[model samples]
Target: MISYLSASYIYPVTGPVLKNGVIGIDPDGLIRTVLSAEEAKNQNIELVTFYEGLLVPGFVNTHCHLELSHLKGKVEQHTGLTDFVQTVMKLRGADDSAIELAMLRADVEMLENGIVAVGDISNQAISSGIKRGSPIYYHTFLEVMGFNPATAKASINRALEFKQKFEGFPLSIVPHAPYSVSAELFEELRLVAEELPGPVSIHNQETPDENAFFERKEGGFLKLYEFLGLDIGFYEPSGKTSLQTVLPMMSDRQKTLLVHNTMSSNADVVFAKALHPLLYWCLCPNANLYIENKLPDVDMLRATGVKITLGTDSLASNTGLSIFAEMLCLQDNFDIPVEELIQWATANGAEFLGISDRYGSFETGKRPGINLLDFEEVNGRIVLGREMRRLY
Candidate 1:
């Protein structure tokens, strides 16, 4: 019932690396002790070893949308966020089976790619890995959007019903975005957050249009709201609130992760870091590029000291569900070190999701939910091995 991981490098967050490490795991999958190869030889266990591989904790993707897994390459760059949203709405209806299949498939992809857990945005009542086999922890953040004042309370009530239905799963209720959620609706959702759990997330500043619309009701989102048969003025929040508006509304337990913060003010990021020492700032780089063709200021986020986590958005907008690839993008464009980037996606992200006790590090008695980082062995580079289940 126990398993041992023989790794070249055991990167525990607390101390120096355990080189030529051997982690002895208990029958329940928690580690017993991380020791040297010599220590491992004296222990009684089943050993899993590779010639050249480093073992680290399973990666945690703080934000994603598994329901839109079917839309990976269907949308193009010229199509911004709103356009992608509309396209999914239209296409999701045309093929229900495909959407379900896509969701399950993406769940598997995440496991294969080494993602141990995710903070997913869920719509329609379908559960990712709920009915299927997925070895990943999911915190499904149910998305709520009701622009009509008449339906604000009713909308929240309905969401509460859904939360009850999925009470068996780890789930939560949250606003979709600043633009899409009305002030009254945000209040209702905030109330829900207070009663529910910690760590809520909302799409804060994904596009310039959303900013314009929130401030002046004067942008592409405003036009879309009108075209979609919704009124902008009816949901009037502060005419010009940004992070300033959301921070106060969010639970002081942790400012909800501000996603796609392409336009977060310096003051906002600073305030967030001050409010929560381990505040998570989630980045959906591909989603930003797919809709607006711009990325959030990565350098600014790194400088602000906000812990960063990666999300693949939906399969509809990305090439694959790979945090490794996401890290590659960060390094390609932002100059972040591989080790630090790995921590953001792995350790820090797990801390934000409130599952660090079970999944974040290669501690002596922790689950090292591992994913194959690289396929080939090469010199002057790290080589990760096959996907392995939690040792329990």
Candidate 2:
């Protein structure tokens, strides 16, 4: 049997909004068709369930760390990136049961927030079990981090073995970040990424120090390296922004997602677009504010016409894991269009994860979960309320 659902507005993301749109869905949640209220009435469809707010495709979170959920509230806020990293390194350990329970809770929290799909970062196999049994779709990015050039091969080998733990799930091996990975490790990861079916992700220039370290071999990160007792004496400054230094090492054919681009300038965006054909910029606004107390130059990124997506980062750096909250944060700060923000939270993220075929928008034969947005008009503009729920 097919059930019909109608809402105040239907945002297909890739298409124009439909007023009082009725979407027909099968019991398995596959979309059968979408029609206007007039069309449904003309067809003599009498059981249409109507709602008072917008209907949108479920959200897609392009970057998250389910493994770090147990660390919520353990780290201080607005400590800057280097200090935040040091705190996380010290507090990332916990009992296995505590970690598992936290992952389960975080998964349910994402589902409750109307998130249907996620691209999560995994450093170990602990999250594999939770993901295997989850109803929400997940694409795991097995992250590899090594700053020593001599450990590059060993790091990739370890990641290869770790990939086996997620045998039945969609996954890819990727580098952690530019500052934590050596040039040799980046090259090795690029070769592995060439064989994978999904895109690569990395924490980009979250602070000025990230660029400073690459440009002149000086920054707060030098202290971080010293704190870890790693010898970087052989490393040389690239005299360029971190993004520029690393973009050339990545394959132009590979799709890459640069996260937390808080310090990325317009020149960095231009250079990356020119060098890489497939690229995505992931914004985790709340986490940026939580750590660095600053937001990205979002206007510059929008003007560059780059493909943008949304992420919640991790519980370590955020109070909650809701893409709706992320959207509201952006809207409050930038006053961007609600429709554009919806695209970033849904379709654009699915595209980056290569799951657009199944989860991005409301198209026939797709099971993109249904979501409702309660909103109130403010000064003739639609301002989304905090009450978002999954309807299907």
- Tell me the TM-score of each prediction against the true structure: 0.87, 0.98
lDDT per residue for candidate 1 within 1-392, as digits (tens), equals 55666756766655566667676666666777777766666664454655355566778888888877777787776577777777777776546677778788888888777888899887657664453356788888888887776778988887877776566777778888866666778778767876776678888787777767657757677667766887555455466546666566566664467788987777778766666553578887866776777889999888877778788787777778877777766666776655676688788888778887887777765775754343234466443333333222
For candidate 2, the C-alpha RMSD (Å) to the true structure equals 1.0
Each model's Cα RMSD: 3.5, 1.0
- Distance from true position, residue 330, model 2, in Å? 0.5
Give one digit per residue, the lDDT tens place, for model 2 in 1-392: 99999988988887888889889999999999888778888888878899999899999999999999999999999999999999998999999999999999999999999999999999999999999999999999999999999999999999999999999899989989999899999889878876895788989999999999999999999999999999899999999999999989877776789999999999999999999999999999999999999999999999999999999999999999999999999988997888999999999999888888889899998898998998888998777887888898
> How much is the lDDT of residue 210 in candidate 1?
72
Ten-residue stretch with the least lDDT total in model 1:
383-392
How does residue 101 of candidate 1 score in lDDT?
83
Clashing pairs in 1: 28-392, 29-391, 29-392, 31-364, 31-365, 31-366, 71-316, 72-315, 72-316, 80-291
TM-score of 1: 0.87
